[model samples]
Target: MMRQRILVVDDEPQIQRFLRPALDAAGFDVETAATAAEAKRLAATRAPDLIVLDLGLPDGDGKTVIETVRAFSSVPIIVLSARDQEIEKIAALDLGADDYVEKPFGIGELLARIRVALRHAEPAGPLPGPEAFGPVVLDRDRRTVTRDDRLIHLTPKEYDLFVLLADNAGRVVTHGTALQRLWGPAHKDDAQYLRVLVGQLRAKLGGEAASLIINEAGVGYRLVTS
Candidate 1:
């Protein structure tokens, strides 16, 4: 099989130097861009399988790169930034990034996230049956959730929230995206509403199964399928 191509967009030479060989060693075909303009050009023409982007670009903010790329492609884009502010993360994610990795990050963690993004980008196959996370099983066709063969009831909003997380299992679902999907664009910044819905859903899932919903502080939630 051909190695998956990763477009690394960062203005810092050291970051390029650090990630090029690392991503190559990790079995990816790596390409680098040092400015937002070049990043957008390469993204449009190169057909990279994934993109590792830095928010601080010499020509423009990385978020614009995300917005531009997202306009035409669903290829996974993972933000690699030094900015740790919650707003920065939310903006990147809401703009269509698949994942965000803070600067001074571990190579192992970054690699793991890259793998998850690649996996998520792959074409999904038909589900054989109800999707299970730990002891909780969600039967989307039947619109029911069950834990250990016992029925677990959920309100409409709670069910929608769970479905969103479950569909994006193993990846962070940003607060903005979740709220907008569940409550429309007007409530996109209403993280508290998401929190309450999550709590209610977790309570219904109950016991060890409740742990399936993993919280990414200041970011969003991830559903642990395994």
Candidate 2:
């Protein structure tokens, strides 16, 4: 089997040196680029399965690399940057990054995030029936949610919110994306509405099942399958 390729875009030699062998040992064919220009060029020409990008690039902002690559491919991009500001994370995510890792990160955590992104990028097979996470089952065809065989009633908006999180289980769904999808573009900035809706949904899900909806704080929420 061909090893999955990872494009590592970072200006710091330390980071490159740190990740190359670790990623290689983890079974990825690794490629490195130090500037935005190089990153974009390699991304287009190399067709890597995934990319680990830094926000601060010598030639330009890393987010632009995300925009440029996203224009042509749906390949997963993970932002590995020192910037931990919420706005920076939101911007990277909204710009199409599959995941974000703050700098000084542990290799183990980064590897886990990479695996999740790759799994999500894989083409999904058609669902055989209702999707179950823990005791909660979401029947998309019937538009119903149930917990331990008992029906759990949800409002239309709440159902939509739940479904969105469920669809991207184990991945953080940014607030901007969620708002824009659940509400219209006009209401995309309305975070309070999302908070209220989540609270309501959590109440309905109840007990340990409600805990499945994990909050990403300033980012958004992720539905934990495990």
Candidate 3:
């Protein structure tokens, strides 16, 4: 069987030192790049199965790398960065990153998220048609969403959260469940992540459609279907 390839892009030598071995031990064929320029070049030539990207690089911002790679590829990207600000996380996710891990992270958690991302990336069997909740519509198969016949752009995480709630429309999706489904078990207690995603989802949804996602307060959220 061909080993799964992973491209690790980070400028920190210490980070490169540890992640390469950890990923290798976890059975990935690992490659490393220390700069955004290098990462873009390797991504073109290496065609890695997934990319572990860092936000700060010597040559340019990691978001640029994401935009560049997303232009030509849908390869899963998991960002590893020291920026723990919610804005940074939201920005990265909105820019096409599949996942984000804050620095001072546990290798185990990162590995688990990697598994979730890779599994989610696989081609699945046929899915049901677009689901409608009022004006918002989500086409699961195409992974596209529309509101009032116009397209609505959602980040990967936002889409996941939307789908989860959409799948259980009119019912409460506890914060823990939503978090785990979108961010893995390790993030079950990280309600802030879900909150930020929901906030962004609401912003793009706009107006009354934004209110479709109801906050349950210290409990979870509900996608009001009616």
Candidate 4:
């Protein structure tokens, strides 16, 4: 089997030393870059399956590097950083990172996150049963969604969220879990977006049918079943 490639970009030599052996042992082809510039160059050539980045880089901040790479790539990125601020994490996730770990993280947890990030990134066919509830109806296989027998417009993110939830309808999807899976680990605390999104979804489907996607207090949201 071909080894999965993982890019590790950090200014700290210690990070490369600690992460390389661990990743190699896990059967990944490890590539190391000491600066953001090098990371970008390596990413362009190697197209690594995942990236481990430190927020503080020698050439530039990790945010810039992330933006640079994300301009064209949807590659999974896990940010390793010393900063533990909630806003920082949310910003990174919102910008398109796959996950994040605070400094002094466990190798085991990092490995676990990598597996999850990759698992969720895998291609998925549309779910079965023709996604529908109340006024919304989506034929996954046909790539069609309708409201009251008329097509409804959806932005990519909105459609992504709808498909994810519709795929597992009538089940409770925790806010933290959904945000992490869809947006990234950094967005675990951005529950406010959930409310905003749900409201918009309700509006798009018409106010009368808004209850199809129910909110679970103190936990998360779920599709209304009963």
Candidate 5:
């Protein structure tokens, strides 16, 4: 497979300076743009697998760029900005940004999210039929969850989490991974939200099924292997 390319667009030369070399050293085809016009120009020729976009572009609003990009592609977009307002985050996510991140973030977390988006953003084959993990059985295609045939209702995010956890039944999944898979980029550090959601999932799954989802303290969560 070709080394995945990422277009990192930000007006801040400092960000590009720091990120470009890092991404290149890490083996991605890195393209940098300081303005939305320049970004659109590059994007026209090369639709990257993922976009690490900054909202504060010089030429135009980043939201417009997002709209323009979504017009032609469903490429995964992870918004990077200093804005921390809920309204700002909601508007971006509602407008089709897969995720958003505030400034002053650790690059490792960003990379983890990027990996997840690249892994799951593409099209896929048919899902599994009835599948068992611990005491819960899920039919992925039908979106049905049951504990020994008792029905369970999961929110969209919860179901997505369930599927990912089920797919990697025995592996430890970092809280960041779960947030990336479910809430996208912006919520990775919001581990508390995930904690509550996981707690709710455990309650719904009942005691036995609940035990399968284990917390790993400050790291992440894991699914106990049967």
Candidate 6:
């Protein structure tokens, strides 16, 4: 069986050393780079299945690397950083990272996050048809959303949130789950971000579609099809 390739981008030699062996033991083919430039080069040339990136690179900010790689590839990226600030975490997610891990994190948790990202990135065989509630139709395969046959534009974050609800249509998807899925483990307690996104989705998917999303106070939101 072939192994999934993972590129580790961090300026700290100690981190690179620790991650390479651990990830190798975890069944991944790991490659390491110390600078953003090298990271981008390896990403393009090596075509890694996932990336474990550090925010502070020697040559440039890791966010820039995320933006640049996002322009050409959708390879799952899990950021490894020391900065645990909510703004920093949100910024990386908004920019296109698949997940984020704060420094001094557990290896077990980091591995779990990597697994989740890889699972989401994998192409599934023959998914069910788009889920519809009223005029709003969500096509998970294409990641395209439409209402009444008219395309509704949503930012990456908004589209992600919408898909999360639509995936569990009629069932409540808790705020913590949504935040963790879209943002990362670090932002699970940040319900305000979820609130803003739900509001934006409601506005974009106006009228009946807006009503389709029912927010349960202090709990979560559910997509109502019936």
TM-score of each: 0.91, 0.93, 0.60, 0.61, 0.66, 0.62
Ranking by TM-score: 2, 1, 5, 6, 4, 3
Instruction: Identify the leading candidate in terms of lDDT.
Output: 2
lDDT of 1 at 109: 90
> lDDT per residue, candidate 2, 67-157, as tens digits?
9999999999999999989999999999999888899999999999899889888897876389899999999889999999999989999
Residue lDDT tens for model 4, 1-226: 8888999999889889999999999989899998889988988889999999898887888887789899878888989999887667656755767667889999998997787677656787555567567778878776667888898787766777777667545444566767877788899889888778777777777766677787755555656433
Candidate 3 residue-wise lDDT, 82-162, digit = tens = 987766666676567866778989999889778766766787667868878888988987899999999998888888888
Clashing pairs in 5: none
Write one digit per residue (lDDT tens) for candidate 5, span 1-226. 6888999999998999988888887779998889999887777788788899898888887888788888898888888999877656656665667666689888886886677667657677677579887778889778989887888988887887788777655444566677877888988778888988888888888877898888755555666556
Q: Rate the local accuracy (lDDT) of all candidates.
A: 0.91, 0.93, 0.84, 0.78, 0.79, 0.85
**Candidate 4: C-alpha lDDT:** 0.78
Model 1, poorest ten-residue lDDT window?
Answer: 124-133
Model 6 earns a TM-score of 0.62
Order of candidate numbers by lDDT, starting with the best: 2, 1, 6, 3, 5, 4
Model 5 bad stretches (over 4 Å): 128-137, 141-202, 206-226
* Cα shift from native, residue 112, model 2 (Å): 1.3
Candidate 3 regions off by >4 Å? 128-226
- Cα lDDT tens digits, model 1, 89-141, are 98898889988889899999999899988888889777637988889889988
